[model samples]
Target chain A: MNAIEIKNLVKTYKGGVKALKGVDLCVAQGDFFALLGANGAGKTTLIGILTGLVNKTGGQVKIFGNDIDVDFEGAKKSIGVVPQEFNFHMFERVQDIVVNQAGYFGIDDSIAVRDSEGILKRVGLWEKRRAIARTLSGGMKRRLMIARGLIHHPRMLILDEPTAGVDVELRHGMWEYLRHINAQGTTILLTTHYLEEVEQMCRNCAIIKEGEIVLLDNVRHLLTRMPQDTYRVTLKERISLEKAQAFNAVKVDDHTLDIEIKKREELNEVILRLAQSGFVITDFHPKGNRLEKLFLEIVSK
Target chain B: MKREYYIALKTILRKETTRILRIWTQTLLPPLITQTLYFVIFGKFIGSQVRSINGIGYMAFIVPGLVMMAVISSAYGNVVASFYGAKFQRNIEEILVSPTPDWVVITGYVLGGIVRGVLVGVLVFAVSLCFAHPMVTHAWAVVLFTLLSSILFSLAALINGIFARNFDEVAFFQNFILTPLIYLGGVFYSIHSLPKVWQEISLYNPLVYMVNGFRYGFFGFSDVDPGVCLLILLGLTVVLTCINLFLFKKGIGLKN
Candidate 1:
């Protein structure tokens, strides 16, 4: 069975603001599925529904084939959520926050306390265990949230923009920790605006726009589906726009021309034509698929 | 079903008690100070001129009313502020998503409010001893009435917290509705001393019955039967508790 399944999910706020129109998604167990979208794109809304934070307007959600509404307790036990906002009690210490979360899952104090220490240490927060949550920095607080979410050893972990506002080093560190956990048989569902993070971490990807799923496929396959390839040709001499236009290329500047080639063979043909025109090609390279392009393509359509 | 509910209830109650204990200065001190002033200004200075009320000295007569007044306000204020603070900080989502049931959440917060209320009431009672010789004529009745009244107000506060959109909304209900009811509910004088029309109207206020019953426990005297007061308090608790639980289940203010 899939780890998490959402079908025909819909959410509309009180003011008739339809945040989620209809979103259908399926994530297999042990898959690091990244749900990519811009701000206000319903990624958080979807997480909220799955975690039971937001009530669904209409639809069905299941965890391991157990209906969310009918078997909510069982579904909740399998899912852990680290929300975008820092939501821990300000007065609660790091250790207490983690252990209390375990207690909420019906785990006794002895086991909860032991697991709390281990999880806090795993997230590099053990030394600061007694510090109040409000005293932690933004990055450290995010790590604390991760530790609290994992205290119960849930089967699935859902992270919403976990790396936002985090330094690159810490972001990478979080990715490594999350990867280790994912490798240990915990399915991960991540929603992040950072395209590079998605590219580096996710095996499968889904992009949502305006409350609807625009694309859902393997990350590698999605990257290959770019309609246009951008190639930068660095000329030995500044070429005139008139001359560059003759070869059906857009002159980005006097020395650089961004050319669109239909096929690999067309690349050599363009270079030969440029050479025949007495224009020396200093460097030539094709730009790989990027999230900016993917986002524009999906949102614009 | 029973086991889960029991566990959730126990945890919530424990957490609430801990919160009050952790912040006794804020939760337990203000009311003790206020009651002291009330005893000095009203019981000592003002009661010197006024005759005995309802066959009891003015100072002893108003003791139960003052105690009930403290319990009601503190009980309501504790839950409204604590629960709404959780909402404001977005920490309520932790419990909202947990395996705990909706009623369990409601009961837990209500129980917290009751603890604060009873604690404040105890503090005020201790302070009142300095002004007048207030005796508990029936220990069981005093305990019963105190617990019941605290629960009633606590449930009301939970409902207020759930429906409140901001801190202003939380304060609005307490400042306007709760405070007025507490002061007008025969805290300073017996309702019988009021005009005939006002006496009939005071019966509509729920706090009046609570004060009268609480006074009955203190002095073995009351304008109304103690059984009637108990029934009214229990009824209010059941009705408000059901409303709070329903609001929680529907995710009324929290989900939005």
Candidate 2:
């Protein structure tokens, strides 16, 4: 069964802003899905419609077989959303925010209290349960939102830019936790600006541009479609500019070269040539976000 | 109501009650302090100088009106501030995204208002008793009018919170619209004291009926017929309820 199914979804705001344009998408149960789009590309709007936060102009949406227009309460019962912004009560303690959200879903207080402890701890916020929400740092606030979203234990979870401003260490931690939940049988639909997150966490992704889906496929397949791979390679010794140019490498510095490898075999061949020229390779890594390169490629088109 | 909606309703009420008691200075004490001053200045100082209305002492005559005023303000203030705060902080999305139906949301908030409004009303009435031994001709009318008026104002306040877009708009409706209506609703004096034309116009103010109906409970005398007042209150209550339910259904001033 599909976790979410959207057929011909459309949303046009006042003053003629077409936020969404007849978008069709689906995510199967227990799958980790990513919806990638630039700002104002209608990613949030589509989520809003599914969550009943925004009225849809026209379309059909079903959550776990419950039609949004016909059985909204049933559809809503199966899903939880952690919005892009912090929307919980700032004056309340961290635990209260999560427990109260459970209450909104009709969970008993006793059950919510019991559930929040586990959820908060899972999000690494059990120690901050008594602290006021506004007092927590931005990352903690984001975690608190995640805790609240999970308190009801819905079958499907939607997170929008969950780690937008988070530091690298915390971002990795979030990625690990999300992976853990997806493995535990909770389907996740994530939208993030961090293409690295998509590469690491999402199994399937759809790139949305101008309110339309431009590409949809397996994450691995999408990466393979990139015609070239850019790498920043560091060397133990400097190589002459003439030798570097011969291999079409940009001399970032005497000891560093920026090279674009067109094929997997080409990378091996280039390394062999550099080694023969007495330029020892010290370290190597992708120059930038590989998925970001493809994302820019698709959206800009 | 479903079991879940009932649970959600209780949750909303519990949260609201906690807030009222937690911030007693803002929600409870201000009305307590304000009403005490009304009993002191209006009933003691200025009241002594004025003659009795309808053969009742001025101090005793204004008791019911003052109590109703507190209920109106406290109930209206509670819903608008709390709900508007939710909207401003976007925390209202907490309930909006839930499975709780629109009626449950409306009931939860209006009940919260009634809780604060009636609590303040009771406190003010107790304070009035210390100054004057106001007669109670019909105890049921006192309780009935209090509930009806609180519910009406609370429904009205929820509408205000819905239409309000910013903090300034919240205060604007309370100051410019509600305050004028309550004061001119015959709180300080009887509608009988106004000129013939003004008395006719005063009947158009819904609060005049509310204040007089409540006074009818205490002194057994009123400027408007109690039966007519009851019908008007009930009718307005239904109208305000319909309007509020419609807004919630349409997600007016709430969803984009």
Candidate 3:
């Protein structure tokens, strides 16, 4: 069974702004899925509809096979959402926020307390349990939100821009923690602008543009779809364009060359040609993340 | 009640009570001080001049009215500020995303207001005791009116909270609408003392019945029949609760 299935979902704001235009999506059980979109691409709107924060204009959403309209409580119980913005009360204590969130799921106070402590400790926030949420640093606050979202032990979790403003060091640890959680069998739907995170963590991905799904496939397949990768190599000696033509390499200048490695061609073959042609290669690396290049192409198109 | 519903209600109630208790200076102390000033200035100092009203000492005459006023304001203020504050801070989304039903959410908030309103009412009643020794002729009547009044005003406050967009909007309702209605509700004087037309107009004001019913409970002297007052309070409560439930189910002011 699918963890989540959204069918012909629609949302039109009060002022005639159609945030979503009949988007249909599905996530398999226990899959680490990425929902990629630019700002205003209706990603948040879709999340809002799923979580009951935004009323849908039309269509159906189901979580763990329960229709949201027919069995809202059942659907709600199956999924937890970590919103893009900090939505918990700022004046509330960290521990209280997590426990109170559990309470909404009808967890008993004693159980909520024990579970809150466990989740907070896992997020490295147990020591700051007594502090008001506003007093926590940005990274700690984000962790608190994650702890709150997980308190109910929902079958599925949705994270919207989970690492938008996090520092590199904190983001690294957060990514590891998220990967650990996903590995534990919680189906996660992540929406992040960071393509590198998608490349590293997501097994399946869907890119939405202007409220419609433009691309959907496995990460590996999407990477394979990119026809070629551009490599920048520093040469040991200057080579004429004519001399580099046999290898399909472009001469940037003295001691520099840009080579496009097609899908059917191997980088080793290029290196072998350079060696036999009496040209030495000093440095070689892809210009950037290959997935990022593909992402840019799709978004720009 | 379902166990889950019970837990959710208890959790929300605990949070709200803690909030009110945490800011005792703002929620409890201000009402105590304000009611004390009203007792000293209006009941003692001014009552000494007027001597008796409706065959009772003026101080005693105003006790039940003043108590009802406190109950009304505190109950309405608690829910309005708490709910609207939740909205302003976007913390209401916490519950909106949960499996808790909309009715439970409304009940939780209204129950919080009732608790605070009754607490403040009791405190104000204790303060009134120092000024006058007004006896409760029917204890159940007093309790019933107080409870119903709190429920009625709390429901109204929830409606106000739903419609309010900012702090200024909240203050606008409190200052322009709620306060005026209370003052004109015969809190300080008997509507019977007014000119015939004004007395008739006072009948149109809903606050008058609430205060009158509460006064009837204390002294058995009421401008309107206590039964009529009870009926109006119950009817308003039902209608307002329906409106609140509709708003929640329709996702007005709560969902985008």
Candidate 4:
């Protein structure tokens, strides 16, 4: 069964702003799926409809095979949501915020208290349990929301940009924790602008463009479809601009070269040509994330 | 109600009660201080010179009205401010996204208001004891009026909270509407003392019945029959609760 099944989803705001126009997609159970969209691309609106925050003009949404319109309570109880914004009360204590969220799901106080300790510790916020939400830093606040979302132990965890502004260390820590949970058969649905995170974490992804699903494919297959690859090479010796322009190269400095190659064969050809030019390559790396380039191309269409 | 939904209601009430106690200075103390001032100035300092009405001292005559005033304001203020705060902070999404039904959510907030309203009412009545000894002639009427009136006001406050876009909107309803109606509800003096037309006009104000019915419970003296007042309170409670439930079901104010 799919974790989420959206059929003909549509949302038009009061002023006739069409946020989602007949979007159809599904995420398989236990899959780490990514929904990639630019700002105002209706990602949040889709999540809102799923979580019952926004009313849907037309759609049939199901979670774990339960239709939201028919069995909304069942669907709601099956998934836990971490919204993009800091939505918890600012004056509430960190521990209370998490436990109270569990209470709304009808979890007993004693059990919520028991689960909050593990979740807060996993999110690296146990020490700050007594602190007020407003006093926490930006990243800690996000983590608090994560802890609150996970308190109910929902089958599916839908995160809307959960780690957008978090530091690298904490972001990686969250990634590891998410991976651990996913391995335990918890389906993860994520929406984020960080294409690198998508590449590193998501197994399957759908790119939504202007309320439509433009692409739905495995992340690996999507990466394989990149028509061109760009690389930056550190050269052992300086190469003349005239010689460097063969592979559509741009000179970073005297000894550094940025190049875009059309095919894998072209890379070898460029390397042979560079070796022939009496310059050896010291280091080489991709200039940009592969998914980002594809996402830009898809969204701009 | 489902067992789980009952648990959710208890959680909301627990949170609200904690907030009421945690900010005692704002929620509990201010009402006591304000009612204390009202008792001192209106009941003790001034009522000594005024003649008795209905064979009862003027101080005792105003006790039920004072107590009712506190109950109405506290009940209205608690729900409006608490629900509005949840909206302003956007934390209300926590409950909206949960499996809890809309009715449970509404009942939870209304019950919270009742807790605060009754606490303030009891405290104000206790304070009134020092200035005037208003005996409770009917225990059942006291319980029913206090609970029902607070329920009505709490439901009204939720409606206001839904329509309010800012703090000013919240305060406007309390000040321009609720406060004036409460004062004109015969809190300080009997509506019978007013001219016949004014007494008739005062009957149109809903608070008049609530205040007088609650007073009837205390001193067994009221301008309107206690039965009629109770029927009005009961009818209003039913109609307002239906309106609130309809608003929640339709997602008016709280949802898109």
Candidate 5:
């Protein structure tokens, strides 16, 4: 069974702002799914609806085959969410926050405390267990949030922009921790603007644009769907616009031009033409299809 | 459902109690200072000339009223501020998403407010002994009325907190509605001293029953029957609690 199923989910806020327009999604059990979108692309709204924070205007959401509205308690017991914003109690200690979350799930104090300490240690926050949430750094706080979410050992975890303000080193560390958790059979649904992280971590991907799912497929399959190939050519001398245009290339900068080649043989022809024009090609490389490029291509249309 | 509700309620109440105790400088000390000033100004200076009305000393006549006032204000203030602060920080989402029932959330916050209210009331009662020798004419009535009033106001505060849009809104309700009701509830004087028209109007104010019932506990005398006071308080609590539970279930102010 799928860990989460969202079908025709719609959310329209007050004042005629339609945040989500019938989004349909299904996350298979134990799959690492990346939900990608631009700012205000309904990523947060979708998360809110799935977690029962935002009221759905219409549609159905199911977790573990249980309808969210009909079996809310059952669905919620299997899911945990780490929100995009730092939404923890500032005055609460790290240990207290995690244990309290467990308590909310009906875990007794002894079990909750044991689980909380282990999760905190796994997140490298055990030493700061007694420190207030506000006193922790942004990265540490995010880790604390992750630990709090995992305190009850939920089957599925949803992370919304978990690395938004985190430093690069901490972001990498978080990815490792999340990957380890995912490896242990916990399904992860993540939303992030960081394309590189999604490309590296998620096996499946969904891109949302204007409250609709623009694309949803295996991560590798989506990358392979790009028809045009991008080549970054470093020129010894800046070329004229007309000269560059003659070879079907666009000048990216003073000494670099991006050429889109449809056929692999066309690359040789373009380089030869550039060489004949006395333009020295210092370096040339093909740019792999990145999520940013795919996003631009899909959304711009 | 029962298990999760019980655990959530216990956790929320514990957290709130810890918050009040942790911020003793703000929550506990301020009220103590305020009550001491009331004793100095109203009890010693003002009561020196005023005679006892109901066979109790002037200072003793107002002690229960003042204690109830403190309890009501603090009970309402504590929950309104704490719960609104949780909402403002967005941490309330953690509780909302849990398996705990909506009524459990409402009851948890209401219990937290009552704990703070009753604690402050007890402390103020202890401090009042320094000024006047007041006897508890009916121990069970005093305790019962105190607990009922605390629960009633705490539930009221929880509703206020849930509906409050921001910190200013939380303070606005307490300042505008709650404080005025406390003062106008005959906290300082008897309704008999007022004109017939004003006295009739005072009977409509709910806080008047709370104060009069509480005073009756301490002195065995009241402007209204003790039974009437208990009935009014119990009725108000049931009605307010139902409204709060309904609001929580509907996610009225929380969906935003």
Candidate 6:
């Protein structure tokens, strides 16, 4: 039972801007899927089509086996989307926004109240439930969107840039909440620029480029495919350019060097060469995240 | 599934009603003050000098028309502002992405307009009672005409909101089209008082039938045939509703 299946999806905007050429992808039931793409790679358009916000030029979309064209309501009922933009009413109170969303799903008043409270509390917005939505901070607003998107207990949740503006602390909290819900069997389709988030949360990953899925595989498998890792090394003192050039390290500055290491290369060999050359390593870190490295590798290819 | 639409309708109704009440100063107060001014200036100050038109007290003659005008504006304004506000803020996507049907969304917004229109109409009518001893010759006719007129304007406003891209577009329809039609619809003076040439032109305005039909319900007298007026109103309501539904189905100016 796939949570979502899109086949040959096409979308050409009004002025002939081809947003999606022919995107095909699938997210297994209860899987946390990460959809990574560049700015104009049609990630938002794909999510818009799935949520019925954008009319597709061609292709088929199914949610939990219900075809969108054949059973529009059924397909819609199975999914909830948190769009990239803040689309909820700004004048309404935080509680009404979530409760009203539940109402649209045919949840009764009592249940709506209970669920709204539960979700609001989970999102740490219970205390501010009576406040107008616009008065809340940016992170709180993002959490409110999450609460509203989950009020109906959708089988699949699509979040587009959900943590774009969130701080590190709040982002971690939101990630925990998302993991909790996903653990409870809600399939989450997350689109994010934060590759670290995808590494931390998503099990299966798909990278879309130019409106098409160019890579789709398990997160670990994709990371394992990377043949080399780049690291930024800080030295105690500046080494001669010739000494660094012998190891083919790029001198970033007087005391810093950028080094690339193959997966099977011995770290001691590189460090020993620097050591023998009178260079003492002070600090070292990967230049980029593993997923990010792979993402850049695949997209650039 | 059977309960889905009903629940959505109820939720939307509650939200819209809350919205209407939340901003009472903006939504309700302006119409009350505006209509009251009309009664005092047009019905008392100028109406005294004019005496009576069509053998009825001038104040009483304009009461139905004034109330009808309020109904049209309030109903139309409520839906137009509310729906366009939804569009402007992009919050309409909440319902657009849900399982709620398009008809349910239309009905919810139309009913919101109707509620505001009817409430304003009744309030104006109550205010009219202080100025003129207006009597309802057919209570059912008054209710029927008021409901029909509200529905008509509500649907019209929905159409306007759907086509409107910005606040200026919404105001353009109201000021250029709606306000002018209402004025020429014979709110202050009876069309019969005008020269036969202008009277002939007035007949082309659909609002004349709505105003006359409502006036007929109050005094059992009308400038046009009340039966014809009712049929015309019914026909227009059907047409506007069909057009609105078609727009929603096509997602015009809504989905992209």
What ranges in model 5 sit over 4 Å off?
Answer: A233-289
Candidate 4: C-alpha RMSD to true structure equals 1.4
Candidate maximizing TM-score: 2
Error of 3 at A277 (Å): 6.4
Tens digits of per-residue lDDT for model 1 on A102-162? Answer: 7667777778788888888889999999998999999999999999888889999999999
**Least accurate stretch of 10 residues (summed lDDT) in model 5 chain A?**
A261-270
Q: Write the per-residue lDDT of candidate 2 for residues A1-301, one digit (tens) a residue.
A: 6998999999999999998899999999999999999999989998899888899999899899999889999999888899999998888989999988999999999999999989898888999999999999999999998888889998999999999999998899999999998999999999999998999999999989888988899999998988889889999998779978987889999998999898555677888988888878999888998899999989998
State the C-alpha lDDT per candidate: 0.86, 0.91, 0.91, 0.91, 0.88, 0.92
- Candidate 6: which stretches are off by over 4 Å? A235-238, A253-255, A268-282
Error of 2 at A87 (Å): 1.1
Q: Which stretches of candidate 1 lie over 4 Å from their true place?
A: A227-289, B1-7
Model 3 chain B: lowest-lDDT 10 consecutive positions: B45-54
Instruction: Give the lDDT of residue A13 in candidate 6.
Output: 93
TM (chain A), candidate 4: 0.95
Task: Give lDDT tens digits, candidate 5, residues B1-256.
Answer: 5776778788888888999999988887788789889988998999888988867788988899889988888888888888889889999988987888887877777788788888889999999999987899898888888889888988888888888887888888888888888899988898888999989999999999999999888888899889999999999999998998888777888874
With candidate 1 superimposed using the best TM-score fit, by how many Å does residue B197's alpha carbon deviate from the native? 1.1
- Worst 10-residue lDDT window for candidate 2 chain A reads A262-271
TM-score per prediction, in order, is 0.91, 0.98, 0.96, 0.98, 0.92, 0.96
In model 3, which regions exceed 4 Å deviation? A234-258, A273-283
Identify the candidate with maximal DockQ: 2
- Residue-level lDDT of model 3, residues A1-301, one tens digit each, is 8998999998999999998998999999899999998899999999898888999999889889999989999899888889999989998999999999999999999999999888999999999999999999999999999999999998889999999999999899888988998899999999999998999899999999889999999998998999999899888988887886766878888788888999999789988988898878899988778888887788899
lDDT of 4 at B24: 88
- Over A100-190, each residue of candidate 5 has an lDDT whose tens digit, in order, gives 9988888888899988878988899999999989999888999998998898899999999999989999999999999999999999999
TM-score of chain B of each: 0.96, 0.98, 0.98, 0.98, 0.97, 0.97
* Candidate 2 docking class: high
Chain B TM, cand. 4: 0.98
